[model samples]
Target: MESTAGRLTRKTAIISGAGSGIGAATAELFAREGASVVVTDKDGSSAASTAERIREEGGVAEPFTADVSDEAAVIELVAFTAQRFGGIDIVQNYASNRSLVPFDVAIAEADLSVWVQQLSVDLLGCVLTAKHALPHMVRAGSGSIVNVSSLGAWLSFESRPAYTTSKAAVIGLSKSLATEYGKQGIRCNVIAPGHIVSAGTENMYSDEQTEVMLDHVSAPRLGRPDDVALAALFLASPESSFINGQVIVVDGGMSAYAPMVPSFRRLAEAT
Candidate 1:
């Protein structure tokens, strides 16, 4: 059989939250594309499972456990990857504390804990990962860093104040990294995903919300993890070497239109 060479051949990638959802999908994709994938997640079993899946498909991968919210854990995670892989060429910050039930709370109803916890996972986590990973990338003189943000960063939804704020801060961080590290041969980018389907959202969507998504998104169907994975792949590879400090919104054109636009309204009742 002919070998399936890829853009990331011989590269090393460290992906956080790679046990499931977009993180898992990105890890699998990165491995398939020929990078040595370091998959980390809070759930040891899931992380192992993801790595095993990649290995089953003839990809190089290993599992690690880390809580992105904890500085010690994040530091250890990066150190472990550098030790295992010899160096780091790519880093994808895909970790977040995705709250299913208590995510959409108004500020007045939310406690300080909510803000702290959300910022810790959604924002500080990325900072910690990048802070550690950049040194390796700088030494190598070339590296790509991709951070996973959300569409909520730009658009206003129900009532996810904390989530929205944290995501918005991600955009700022991305730009700053691009500016400070561009001269160092390091590239930093952010991915803003739309309504991607995952285990967490398998049953989270209501009928009305589904209709809204269908209308808002330009793509005929909802988003899959593969969709986001493809974007991350581009950002991590040399194909996007010149693209830095940018937000690649993977929303299927959902965020491109206004709520009252005729096109959105047309799709709302097209069925």
Candidate 2:
């Protein structure tokens, strides 16, 4: 019997915001699956740490510090990846600005700077990354771009207007890329992840708040970074060759129905 090779064998991937959370997990998993990984982040030290861990685990990885909001930085990052790895096959756009939950407000009350900052990092960053990386993939004759959006893009939030807007825009941007590039052997897709337990999330929500949020999820537990990472792996691999211009929601079925109905039904049952 012949043995199966790793799904990503000979593939080279650049994963932005890979210093932690879903990005970090995806980076590591991609490496294990045989992709040469470029782990990049806005935080230099954090990027180095993630790269070092991948190296320790016997995976090929390199660390680069880049603020994706800056086109020059993204250009440099793409150039470096292609130069160091020979070409780019996969790009996971995951870098995002710090959570603006505290300051983000309804449009009527939102500051111009708030919208600018949020879109610069969340939306424009993905654009810049794709813009610079596309040529490399086109030249390679095949490539995959997996963009990380948010479930917030689908749900209306009383606050976080900027975040939701940016995320929703990502979906549109991805579809456009897929349409333009599919014939060129390039595919683009969006991953809209729901609430996941991560360092950033732990800082953002209290324990009580977490419990309340979990009640809305149909899954027995809240999502983990690996859950989304695994989804990314499949999308980025050859298995998804026919999957393009799609959005995969990895939210543990949180968005499947009216969350309040489930809680209200439980309350009625108890009564």
Candidate 3:
């Protein structure tokens, strides 16, 4: 398929929050697939390390430091990529900054300042990146954008209203953009990953909590960062050209089943 035709050869991809987790994983994968990847994160050291690893793997990569929520920084990031790589064929917005505390506490106990900080980075961040990157893409008349949302967008959990709201909004935003830009040759999509195992998860779940979560998943094991990255690659590639304004849930069947924790032992015993 022409969609897979050189699979990113000579193409350029810009990913935000590439310092860790899904962002870092996607950056490495895109590089490996033959794209010149620009890795950006608020943490310079971590972003640099991600880029270095990609370089070690014979992939072309570079690191930059930027806060994706900042309008000026986002604009600069777009410009920098164009200057560095000549043009951008793919854009992935993966920067999110929010402490996963219970929402009720934040609403009742915390100040307004805290709320704004959460929305500014998580919800507004994706908007800002798309706003800045779209025009560059429109000028070229073709591009693909993959926005990283989360399973929280669809289902409710304890203590994370802000994060959930923000992620949910990303799906709506992507759909709106996709509708507006389809004629312009720019395809916008969302990838909602559920319960990925990473440093972030270590902070969010205890060992027991992780086990309970995995037991509920239809897939046998917890999702790795590479799993999400590979999905992003398909959406970003021409292989999925007809796909637009859609949210792909890569959650090991977590979203497909009931919300309660499952008992693997019980199922096995029945068998």
Task: Using TM-score, give the best candidate's number.
Answer: 2
267: Cα error in model 3, Å: 9.6
Question: In candidate 2, how many clashes are counted?
Answer: 0
What's the TM-score of each model vs. the native? 0.93, 0.95, 0.92
Residue-by-residue lDDT tens digits, candidate 2, 1-271: 1112578999999999999888998898888888999999999898899899989988899999999999999999999999999999999988887667787887888888989998998899889999999999988889999999999998976789899999999999999999999999999999999998876577887889899889888899999988988889989998999999999999999899965788688999999
Q: What is candidate 2's CA lDDT for residue 238?
A: 88
Better of 1 and 3 by lDDT: 1
- lDDT for every model? 0.88, 0.90, 0.85
Report how far off residue 176 is in candidate 1 (Å).
0.7
Instruction: Report the lDDT tens digits of candidate 3 across residue range 199-242.
Output: 66767788899988887788989998888988999999888999
Instruction: Tell how far residue 71 is off in model 2, in angstroms.
Output: 0.7
Q: Is candidate 2 or candidate 3 better by lDDT?
A: 2
All predictions: root-mean-square deviation over Cα? Answer: 2.7, 2.6, 3.2
Check candidate 3 and list the clashing pairs.
102-159
Count clashing residue pairs per candidate: 0, 0, 1
